[model samples]
Target: MAMLDVKNTKLYISYGIVGCGNMSQAFFGRLFKDNKNKQRRVIMTYTPSNTRAHELADSIGGTSVKNLKYLNHTEVICLCFKPQQLKRFLTDAREIDFSGKTIVSILAGVDLKTLKEYFPNSPIIRLMPSMPVENGQGISLISHTDDVSKKVLDELELLSSKHSMVIKLEEKLFDKLTLVTSSGPAFVYYLFASFAKSLEEAGIRKDNSKEIIHKLFLGALSMIKNDKRDVEDLIADVCSFKGVTAAGIEELGRQNVSESILGAIDKGVERSRELQSEVRSDLPNLQ
Candidate 1:
């Protein structure tokens, strides 16, 4: 692969990923999946173990660098490491000069303020991407500091828009959006598993139950997306007076399942805030 000329304004933005975890792999893997004939985007991946870094780099046709200093050439540095590891990572990486580069962080609880303290000269962008990006179907919520240039923002949007719906919002709303978009996939999987398990208990084969539930969800979501009627109206369509579906709906209401789901979301949002506070408390005082 040709070395990217960072000085070139027309070339695709080069990315240096500091952590090669699942999310990073999935996100970048999908990004580079269709670049067979085109110039592969320059991506420098690094991790302490170097195992995942090499794996991701190989899969994406990018380079796996040995350490942080090697990433200085890239225009964008994506911090995909764990939130709790930020302080330590910064300490170990103190020698690298990050001036003028864009710091894109996907850390769950680490906010932009803390990132600004670490990379004072670099523009920071906080992005929250859900798991579905692995399959090129995902939602990403982004918040950036005022210092970020429109060109860089446009480049990021161009890269991510192909695989995910990118929504730009204020940093203050990140935690709430994280609950719905970031943590939402797991919650949805839990519901799917619960329904599948119930089917298993009712004597359906486990594999068949899972497939059935998967298709069921896809069909329901398709209707919700395409149908003009309100969701309640669609529910009404499924539920005839004193019918089997109506009986199930009645039981769900009686059991407060809807309320329970709302409460769970509330708890998730609370936990997100608490995690943010904890990560903030761990940051050392800025010199």
Candidate 2:
């Protein structure tokens, strides 16, 4: 078991990472941002055709291992590859022993059952994290096997909370949460881009239009975060009887925008399920 060393009121741990991608960058970036846990180092890393491993290792004072075999003795492994890459990664990692290790998988649509099949000797935790984790403000949806020790889970939760909100949910509800928490940022970005394009069409400077839309979103998000009142009530505050905002709200209502957005989310959920099915079918009986 890895133990934490406390010095001058700080704690640190030793962990390893597999697959260094954008999401891994966000997670570890946030983890190392804080001075206290900056000492909680990544001891090893493996990247598939990316400079991320060496780059991150150099920045964090760690070693970049060319082969997955280096992770065999790691106490905790953060699995950050795509769901579809699970089988390929495992095949490439045949020489790496996962016995008694704790595997934290951030692959979307790969559930606990499938993870257990691939890393039967390790306790698996399925986590869905967003890109905002890079700034220490995101949400991580997690589910774990029953065999995980309470101490390990607590440590994992603390590690995640350093960068984002961590919510524990059953495997059944993870796909639905993935739609909002995981993919929702892109949806919001798309909405803002569309709004910015409209502003540009109205003769606003292109750069100004983008900046204005960005601040508009940042302010709204801040308001929602700080306000205690319900979102509907807040909307009511903005759309009080027969004003410009009211006209916009009326037009959106007439176009059934709410239903349209919900429909989009439903479609995303369906695709998530399909991906899960495809991965499971491809990697059946991995053990």
Candidate 3:
């Protein structure tokens, strides 16, 4: 209840995080690192076995609680566990009261419908945040149930937008967007690694290859960001007829690398749909 208090100029929030996984840490860490204007009072943390909870709480300056009862007075309760863990947590926390609490979820493939069944009295928000959130440059997809109050939605948006580019999307498109934005970063990293390996094989030192290749990406990204020209035009500007870059482009074309990357994205989207179905199936059985 006492989330923000007047103290000179800074405000604070009372946060109670439920899980302490990588994605959870990414979000909370970014919020902690970027929120210079507001102080975050991490009230408590809960994790099975209590090891990670204690570790994360200590790292983030919070207390690790043994039970959900301590979350009663917290302003925000972040559910940062796997989708399948929802039922177990609900069952274990059945004795605790959750009325009027705002629940923020970062579980992939978990829908608002399933969350409503588990937390009928609490306002639920589902968000898919990428790893770059740790640097305050992530793309996050947000969805909420209709019962959420305007004030709560505004507050959540403000908090999320501070650390990432927040987009309000239909829940039906969450899986598809997750494939493109959330999983896309890993795919891009793999592509960068492949390019770095090619450089290494070409007699470049591994460290130098990595450094140069990463800077190449940064340069290309800067060009793309600054220019409004079509990507094909941008490519044309870089590749002269029969030049080294052109030769590389011709080699990629010969290997159908462009089509292959598109195929990979399609496969990723299909897998995302499969995972969504699996989570939904698990939910119906839980009810």
Candidate 4:
């Protein structure tokens, strides 16, 4: 029997990911343990022989294996491969039995119909979770059919504790989220760095500037979470028309940087949609 059944106190979750690259390591190594499997007994593995994969698995406490048969006994498998690596999984993975399992996919372009075609009988879910899941601050945007209910959603929410945040989404909206949240952090990091660098260049010491940036960013995020004010409104609260914040805003406006950021998001969405199309052949609109 699969070890993930909630009623089983001694359950073991077997996660079989197809890739062990950065995303896999970040997700598995950083967040898997937070599941708090008191037994320290979750069985995890991924496609092997790749150096990055092995390194990440070791970092995350997962066993490494190259054989697909390892999944035959797994209960919860999160496929973390790139789009180009999927067909091989579909072809060779058919021999395994997944009668009572859930398969979560992280490939950008693959859709539910295609996932169903390969693992037809298993309950399937598609999502694009950020790598920050390792840090407990990551947001995971997920979409699926019939694999969860409110009760199940609450159960899954438990996984978010101390290490991750999950937002349920309409399957059709996964594409927008893929770019917004999936690929968001790295981009945001660059923006955060710009803010910090500006402070440093303004004569603020590097460490002090970083502390200020982090505190401000955290405070801003908290406000967004606890209040009804929209993000722009919050920024407006800080920019008193001709004040320091406004001055910075005007400078950014002159540089057209915000537009460039928006353009980057648009391009990322388009590219993700294109990849999704190549794999699913009939993915719903990714916008």
lDDT of 1: 0.85
lDDT of each: 0.85, 0.80, 0.79, 0.71
Runs off by more than 4 Å, candidate 2: 1-13, 34-42, 284-287
Q: Which candidate tops lDDT?
A: 1
True-structure lDDT of candidate 2 = 0.80
Judge candidate 3 against the unseen true structure and give its global Cα lDDT, from 0 to 1.
Answer: 0.79
Pairs of residues at least 3 apart in sequence or in different chains that clash in candidate 1: none
Superposition TM-score, candidate 1 onto the true structure: 0.93
- Winner of 2 and 3 under lDDT: 2
Model 1 lDDT per residue over 93-202, tens place = 77678999999999997789888987999999999998898878899889999999777777776677789988899888888888888898998999899999999999
lDDT ranking from best candidate downward = 1, 2, 3, 4
Off by over 4 Å in 4: 1-13, 34-42, 50-62, 91-95, 98-100, 147-156, 199-209, 222-233, 251-259, 280-287
What TM-score would each prediction reach against the true structure?
A: 0.93, 0.89, 0.86, 0.76
Worst 10 residues of 3 by lDDT: 1-10
- Please provide, for model 2 over 1-287, each residue's C-alpha lDDT reduced to its tens digit, 9 standing for 90 to 100: 22332232223445678887788877775665553335454468788764898876765666678888878757788888888888898788889778888899998877788788778889888888899988778999888999886656776677777888888998899998989998999988889989999999999998999999999999998889999989998899999799999999999999999999899899998988888899988884733
Error of 1 at 87 (Å): 1.3
lDDT of 4 by residue, 226-275 (tens): 98999889888889968998998889899998899889988988887778
What are the C-alpha RMSDs, in order, of all predicted structures?
Answer: 4.4, 3.9, 4.4, 5.5
Cα distance off (Å), candidate 4, residue 127? 2.3
